[model samples]
Target chain A: MLNYFLFLVISFVMFAIGAYGLLSKRNMIRMLLSAEVMFNSALLTLLVLAATADPIRGGVVALIAIGVSATEIGVMISVGILFFKVRGEIDVYKLSKSREQKSRRLKT
Target chain B: MIDIIVFAILGTLAIAFSLLVVEHRSLVYGAISLGFLGIVNAALFALIGFTFIALFHLAVYVGAGVVFILFSVTMFREIPTVEIRVKRIALVIVTLIAISLAAIFWPYSNISVVAQSISYRELSKVFTEDYWFPFLVTTIALVTTLIEGITLARREAR
Candidate 1:
């Protein structure tokens, strides 16, 4: 009985905000948080899409997605820690610039 | 009628909290907002009859994910200073793309609005019998990731 369009709109708006944060935020942890939001948006859409046919299936799938996302957070947090240990900073801009320089050096 | 009302309120709150998650200056504040968003989404799941998913979402996402994020935020306590970047064009482009995708998908939403009743037993049977391979793979993957994370973090400790 819920309006599926309404739910989709909410998910899409959340996704846009997350994408904006991912792009604009320089902090690595915040970027990860934004990524979580984007992941939630995808899960929301999937759940809503499957709600009408077989919610149990959606539930199982959502469970899998949730587990995968948790693993993702764990691995990424470890990487963030490693990055901070090596660089003493967690700014995405600086990290990306360094990566670009590394790539250019390899090409040379 | 009640379902629609509940869904509306939950969806609105989820969206609002998600915005706060993205826009908050403090990392802890953003993580808390993200937790709230997860809670609202779990409620939204329940409202639509996915009770088991809602419960698991609440337990895994709101319970574990938020705590993990908070722990990560605390590990690097140095607050990042705001850097002004000329990213207005990027924002506009992302917004336009999202809006177009929404418009294109709107018609399909109306077609599948009906909620069919399904039980947890049915889901488990199907998951174990048909998609058991994926389920087993996920378990293995999770365990491996945990081991890798522990190893990675411990190396820093040493």
Candidate 2:
């Protein structure tokens, strides 16, 4: 019981840290890393729940979730690369500013 | 006794490295921290008796995923420095929400059930027989991602 509780606490802390990063960071790559951290926390929660109740089903779900996470990250990185090539920068604020400038120019 | 100690160490390392992943100035260092975080997470999974999941995580996340991110990050020449203003209100809100969630889920945590020890063979059997459809769907998604990734890479190359 204590073990599971501790695990849950750690998972929650990880989630909070990830949330902070996602909310506060401007770098797109850093934001993606934050999302990955959140995904890890979710996987930890799933595994701990599974460990307590149903290992079989939990294990299967974990396996599929892992696969899906890998594919998700792969696609995200590919997109990030393409975005960087097109924009020449990965900063979220800069991208937004560029769009705003373009809109302002068009309005004038 | 031993398990608690090990879990404590791994848990602390996981949290620390995750912080580093977010706080580091250099993107490459952050990516390296992310890989280390993945390794620590895999260790936690193994400690919880999920050996296969641990290995899979080590291979897929630490092996392939981090490498891909690191490679992409290196392709960029300039690393932008952005000022990060920490939001105290957000921190307080996240803490409150986490505490509330912990309280809500506290009852389920007290069941005192020991997970059954299942062999890989049984896990494989269940995977093949019961959850084949989800498996198929995941495989399809994976294949589509692979093709999309390849196309994107080729476009960048050209």
Candidate 3:
């Protein structure tokens, strides 16, 4: 019981850290890294719960989730590369600011 | 007893590296930290007696995913440090969410923590027999992503 609680706490902390990063970070790559952290936390939680209930099913789901997450990271990094190539900057704030300015100019 | 001690050490390292991944100023260092976190996570899975999942995670996440991020990070010679505009707000939101989650999950704290040793044969049987459809979908997604990645690489080469 104590061990499970400790693992849950760790998973919770990781999830919080990931959330903070996702919310506060502006760099696209950093944001993706943060998202990865969150994904990992969720996976850990799933495995912990599954261990108590059904290990086989948990392992299978985790395997598929890992595969899906790998694909997600690959696609996201590719998009990040393309974004950098086009704008030469990967800052989310700057991207949004540029879009706002464009809209304002169009309104004029 | 030994497993708990090992898990505690790995969990602490996982949290520390995860923080580094988020807070590191240099994108390359941040990516490296993410890789380390992945390694710690794989170790945690292994500690739980899921060796196959541990190896798969190490291979896919640490090997391929982190490498891809590192490769992309190298392309940017000068990455400006991202300024945090709403640290207090973000902190408040995260705390609220964490508290709510804890409350929801408090009932399950009494569950036993037994390390179940799962073999590859049983895992494959369950994967193929029960969850084959999801597996098929995942395979399709993987193939599509591979094709898309190849196209993107070729375009960049041109």
Model 2: per-residue Cα lDDT over A1-108, one tens digit each: 245777888988898888888888777888899898889998988988898888888989999998888888888887778878898777888888899999999999
Q: What stretches of model 3 exceed 4 Å from their correct place?
A: A103-108, B156-158
lDDT of 2 by residue, B6-98 (tens): 777999999999889888888888899999999999888887778898898999888988888888788876576564666676677778877
**Interface RMSD over true interface Cα atoms for each candidate:** 2.1, 2.3, 1.9
TM-score to true structure, per model? 0.91, 0.90, 0.93
Cα lDDT of model 3 by residue, A24-74, tens digit:
999888999999999999988888888888899999999999999999998
Off by over 4 Å in 2: A100-108, B84-86, B109-116, B156-158
Candidate lDDT scores, in order, read: 0.82, 0.84, 0.87
RMSD of each: 2.2, 2.4, 2.0
Chain B alone, TM-score of each model? 0.87, 0.85, 0.90
True contacts kept of each: 0.65, 0.55, 0.67
- Tens digit per residue, CA lDDT, model 1, B84-125: 484696599669968997988877766636655677688889
**DockQ, prediction 1:** 0.63
- Which candidate's DockQ is highest? 3
**Ranking of predictions according to TM-score:** 3, 1, 2
Worst 10 residues of 2 chain B by lDDT: B109-118
Which digits, one per residue and each the tens of the lDDT, describe model 1 over residues A1-108? 556787788888888888888887888888899899999899888888888556777778888899888888887787888888888888878889999999999999
